[model samples]
Target chain A: MAKKFLQRLGLKDKLLAIIVPLLVLAAWQGAVSQKLCSELILTPPLTLLNTLLELAQSGDLTLNILASLKRVMIGFLLGGTSGFVIGILMALSPFLNRIFGPLIKALQQVPEFAWMPLIIMFLGIDEFAKYFFVAIGAFYPMVLNTYQGVSGVPEKYHELARVFDYKSFRYLFKVIIPSALPSIITGIRLSLGLSWMFVVGAELFGSDSGVGYLMTWGRAVFQIDLVMAGLILVGVIGFAMNFLLERAEKQFLLWREPVDGRPA
Target chain B: MSNNKGTLEIRNLSKSFIVDNSPLQILNNINLTVTSGSFVSIVGSSGCGKTTLLRIILGLENHYDGEALMDGKQIVGPGTNRGIVFQDHRLLPWLTVGENVAFGLDKLNRKEKKLLVDEHLQLVGLIGFESVYPSQLSGGMAQRVAIARALANKPEMLLLDEPLGALDALTRMYMQKELERLWQLEKITMIMVTHDIEEAIYLSDKVVIMSSRPGIIKQIIDVSSSRPRDRASSEFMQIKAEILEEFHLGTEYTFAYAI
Candidate 1:
């Protein structure tokens, strides 16, 4: 009965999700009006909104966003493609799996930021260093997810391929890859989030141009409003990217039945 | 060597499995012959090696010591000439009914593939469900699509491993009639492994009864009844009684321990 009631109140549930955020914003405004927190530390929501508008009007916001987006695209393409290839190869061959499996596991244990200092020293704090960091962040999850996806394909599908006498290429593309696609898409989504997080870490140390750099610049100048605005923009963009990818996943996996047996 | 195009001859077939460091035999000295354009059923209780025998004939298991020959050629491994439908309708979940049927016809041109798939879908009475996915179909419909997929290859011999075993009794009965109709229409050699004695008698030209514990053929009873034979007929009852007697399930047991 409760499930049916909840299902009927779908729109209300969506509205309810925003209630906590609204209450927090109201409390923040109250604190700022009463001067409970200094502007240098907190930078109340209205002041941050004004700073965001000013930055947008001056074109600084668009420039930083474009720069960061460019870095993410290049790093994502290089990391995602290589990881996909390597993952498939490892799953296909036992020799490669045995050789690289332990090495990858060890690398994954090290945080993406841990390599920042050494990478900057090698590449000299240029665009290449940032790209490398983001790529590294994206690569590990992609590889692990792809390997799991490919290896987890049902043995029965392989038997069907054999019975049909399918060619190797056809079998791989039609059976193995499609069967593993849901897991692969999930990995790609995770890598996308990692790339965003790594971009911030990459820019926090030594960069002049990207959204991450803008936040650091605001911190150095003691412009707390600008910093808060930058953080909000980053969060909004990440949320938007995730939403878009979820839609794409739905489009690609139309054949999957909904777990709750709901109509499409 | 059998002169008929679809004749399958199995000779001195035996299979064993390594269980806990000891060799356990599964099928022992099994031999059977299925002629062209005939339906043969292997009926036995679970663990009677009926499925193992089908797997051997399909050439999925090469470890068995025997010769399974089709049209005078020794079977080696899975080939397109032999199509199979497993007990669980192993259709690819990502594909629609039409695509699943066309899966085995990869060598055919696109137009030819479509035509064959459509024809077989119609043959299995699933003509309007071409675009539907397997998950959306009922158990019986899914099994029919599996049948269509198997027949799409136009194989010389079709192997079914209890194809309707997962369906309800009503659906099973309907599918049994459908199987008979399909056999009459297609005229291909078919070998089905089933647990239902009545089902075996209803659809098959010959019922091969097997015994458990290193499974071997106990008897092969030929059904000389004509097509559309009545299930309640005296002849049908006689054949059913004979098969039940082999399994020690005959009517004689009812009065054996009378109070």
Candidate 2:
């Protein structure tokens, strides 16, 4: 009876997910309003919402968020395409892998920020440096995932390819790529996430625009509220993008999943 | 050197593998000939290299000691003349059933490819299941799709590596009959490797039994019993006992072991 009642309750995942965040917000508000914590440290949720409104009224939030998003998109595409092509080439030919694999592996081991000094030194604190840094950040995950996906195609499928006498290009497109698509999509998701992170890091080095610059400017002005607002925006937008992409990925690879019964 | 388009000749084929740094022979100088449009089944226990022999004929294993000739040409690597149905369905999971069937027909025009795909799906009794993924299909249905994929290629010989070995008893029996009907309908050369001796006897023109551990053909028994032959008949039991004697599983041998 209890189980049936629980089933009938029909608590949707979204409803359940919102509960914890709401509780945290309520707790933070209680701490601030009760004067149990420093006001500057634990800004109330309402205060953050008001700060968002003020920033929107000033048009700063919109501009800075747009700037960061633009960098993330451009960098993701640049990194994703090159990584995909190079990954396929390396996976297909051992000679190419032998020549370039070691150097790429070594380069990837170096952190994304480690290249910033040299990048900024050559290109200066401009959009170019930010793009380059974010692109490099996105590159490693995409390349590694794509390489794994292509190379790890099952031997059974390869036998089918051989049995059918497929040519090299046809095999690559029809079998290898389709087989590796799930992994490639995983790589893309991870790369987009990393690029988002790197864009902010790049902007923080020195920039006049972007949410990273807003946070830095807020710090310069000693206004902790602005910094909090910037942090909240970054977290929410990043999370929302990731959540949407995951849904899209699932929809795109529907054929990869098994359906229950034959459709009427 | 004879130009028998559908005939296959295996000349003293031998294969060995380096297992744990020691050379272990798998196939021991195997020789067989399959005439055009005939069904030949190879039956043996596991580790007997029965599958290995099928692989050799399928042009999968290249390092074997001898030659496999299909028609007048040497069977070197995988070619268009032979279609293989692996033990597993091995269908591309990302593709729909129709796409999997038409995978090899990329060179053909769209209309021709669609027609062929439809015809083969119909042949395998899966006409309405064209849009579903392989994962959605049951084991038997997926196996049928695999067979359809192979048949769509129009190969001279169909190589089966225990295709129905994974099915339940009822499905296995049904598929055995379906396979026989398919063979009769297609009238193409078929070489199947199976563990079910009854399956071998019911479908093939001849049943070739192999002994395990460096596998060799111990005997080739021609099952000239009529189409859809009775499984419970005394003649069938006699042949079954004869095969059991070769495997040392006959009643007399069992009684001897018990004593």
Candidate 3:
């Protein structure tokens, strides 16, 4: 009975999600204006907004965002495509799987951050080093998801491939790839998210440009409002990317029937 | 539309598997021949290895002991000469009906592929459903798409592994008529694996009934009844009775063979 009541009491309108955040913001602003919290620790809401607009007006925000986006996009593209292909190969070939599967798995167990010192030592604190690090971040999830998708394809489709006498290339490209697309899409989404985090981390650690660098500079100067603005932009952009990918999935996967009016 | 091809002969075709480190025989000493442009149904109770037999004929199960020959050639692996409609239809969910039909025709030009797809869809009576997805279709409709996909390849032999088994009774009866019509119109050999005896009687030139526990043909009964067969006729009932007796389930007697 309590569970039923909770179910019914759940957000009746999705717009209701904005309420608590708005309330918290209003309280935060009220406290900050009255000096109940120090400006050094928590920048006032109005000051934060001013800093955001000023950054936009001066085009610094745009430059920083573009720099960050370039790194993320390149890293994601390089990592995602290779991950997809290599994952499929791993699933298809027993010899390749035996050779590299366990080695990769063992490497993944070592913290990714652990690779940073070795990478910086060899490549130096340059753009290539950052790109390489971010690419590594994008690689793991994409490979895992693509491997699962290809390996776990229903046996019936394999039978169909046999009946058609599809050559290996045709079998992989036409049947295996398409059948595993939904899973690959999942990998791409996850890998994109990882790439975003990785680019930000790379910039924070070394780069003299990008949103992460801007936040680092703001901290060096004690400009808390600029740091807050950068955080807001990151959250909003990440949300937008996720939303667009979801919409694309719905469009391409229209053949799948939904359950309870939600896309399956 | 008759041609001098799609003749299949199974000679001493026996199969076994290493189940739990023991050689568990699945099929034993099976022998059958299906002529070109004929409709044959293999009927038996569950565990009869009828599906395995079809897979062997389809050249998917290649570890069998003896030869499964088609048109005087040894059936080795799956070829474009044979197309199969699996029990669940098995249409690729991401593909539309038209794309699914066009899937196997890699050698053809785009225009030829489109024409063949349209023609096969028409033959299966699903011509306007080209843009539709399998999930948007009914079970019977999906099975029709499967048939259309198989026919699109223009194979000499079409294998159906209980293609209509998932449909409701009314739809099954309707599809029985549809299958008969399709077989007659296409003039190709069709080998269907079914457990439905009356379905076997209604559509097949020959009904090969097998016994379980080492699936072997118990009888190959010929039905020479004319086209558009009557299910309610005494002849149909008698054939149903004969099949039920072979399975030792003869008492029930009620069948539109849609059961």
For residues A1-264, what per-residue lDDT tens digits would candidate 2 score against the true structure? 755664578966667578769989999999899999988877788998999999999998899999999999999889988899899888888999998799999998897778988998899988877888899988888998999999999898888888788768888898999899999999999999999999989888899999999999988998888889889988998899899989999998987755555321
Put down candidate 3 lDDT per residue, A3-23, tens digits, no spaces. Answer: 566458785445456866788
Instruction: Report the C-alpha lDDT of model 1 over B34-132, residue by residue, as the tens digit.
Output: 999889999999999999899888888889788888778888889877889999899898899999999998889999998998899989989989898
Sorted on lDDT, best first, the list reads 1, 2, 3
Better of 1 and 3 by DockQ: 3
List fnat per candidate, in order.
0.61, 0.66, 0.76
Off by over 4 Å in 3: A1-12, A260-264, B251-259
Better of 1 and 3 by TM-score: 3
Return the clash pairs for model 3, or none. Answer: none
lDDT per residue, candidate 2, B70-173, as tens digits? 88678789887888888888888889999999988888999999999999999999999999988788889999999999899888889999999988999999
lDDT of 1 at A228: 86
lDDT of 3 by residue, B10-39 (tens): 999999989999999999999999999999
Highest TM-score against the true fold, candidate:
3
* TM-score on alpha carbons, each prediction: 0.94, 0.91, 0.94
